[model samples]
Target: MTSAPSVLVVLPSLVAGFLACLGLIVAIGAQNAFVLRQGIRREHVAAVVVLCTAGDLVLVTAGIAGLGPLVASRPAALTAARWFGAAFLAYLAVAAVRRARRPERLDPAGTASGTERASRRAVVLTCLALTFLNPHVYLDTVVLLGSLAHQQAAAWAFGAGAVLASTAWFTALGFGATRLAPLFARPRAWQVLDLAVAAVMAALAVTLVVA
Candidate 1:
């Protein structure tokens, strides 16, 4: 049985963990854009959300287990990640550009034709690459959040809160994005979105190279 006082002490750390994770994740990025696109298309939303949350869970757990410092110490690894991530992002950007040139309309059901839809394997691979290939993901979860977790009295509790935050965020983003489906029914809307996605990916790739 836990005492009230102990519970009180744990609550703040938990809240802090939640807020910290939310701050890190609730941003515009390649991963978010991919999820949003899939959601709007109503293609494999649940799988994408689950994989994203799971990736975060694994990274955050590694961070909490004291791998954060070791990761931070290895600048070479991060540089390697950045290069690979930049190349991947560039490839995605070009693909988005090509997609924009051939925009397809969404049906009333918010799904494209079967012929136009990507295979589950392709989507899964892209989602995994977007989630894990980025070095910022490492810095945010492993180095930054891990260090922050250690600052709290109950590190595992903090990690739990962080994981919960990630799960909630990805679920909301991937699922909630469907609310904009009607607006995206037009082919022009999809073209604009693909162009926007291309721009963002290109900019991020440039930033990675110059950083």
Candidate 2:
């Protein structure tokens, strides 16, 4: 009798891959906070959401397609990534501190005409920088996820499924938070959010340094 077709191999792998990928993504950080803020502000909501999700997809694809092995093989590259990521987090911490100190003017009148445009650009740039600049993202998504996916029964299919999970999670977060913009309209709320973001960035920086 012929052995079972290789196609059967993909089924179990896909499930394992999805869970592994989701676990890595659910951690809240500067990136997720920025996306949620854009959503709450209703500023470039669609563009910011799509850009973040799409960027993750690209990185996930790169990781699965042998880039993981390349990075793992290069000790210098990984070390550079760690330092770069730490520095970027430090920069974010400074920005967050500045926002926290700024005076809050809640009235729509205080909202500049170019606010949305600027926010849109900031969201895209921040998402890309957070994803690509930091070494942790590469280590987690590329090295960890890629390596784990390959070990599964159907490596390629599992990796693709995991990438899809990442896309779905970010998209949902971006759009879902936008619907709550009214709650964030208050100046105090924005201040709190800014402070919280600053704290998170600082903590991430510390973690990077210690790691």
Error at 135, model 2, angstroms? 0.9
Tens digits of per-residue lDDT for model 2 on 13-58? 8778778888888887877887876666656767776776677677
lDDT for 175 in candidate 2 is 80
Which of the numbered candidates is closest to the native, going by highest TM-score? 1
For each of the candidates, the C-alpha root-mean-square deviation to the true structure, in angstroms, is 2.2, 3.2
Q: What is the lDDT of residue 172 in candidate 2?
A: 83
When summed lDDT is taken over every stretch of 10 residues in candidate 1, the lowest stretch is: 106-115
lDDT of 1 by residue, 16-83 (tens): 88999999989888999999999888889999999999999999999999999999999999999999
TM-scores of all models?
0.94, 0.85
Cα misplacement distance, residue 4 of candidate 2 (Å): 11
Candidate maximizing lDDT: 1
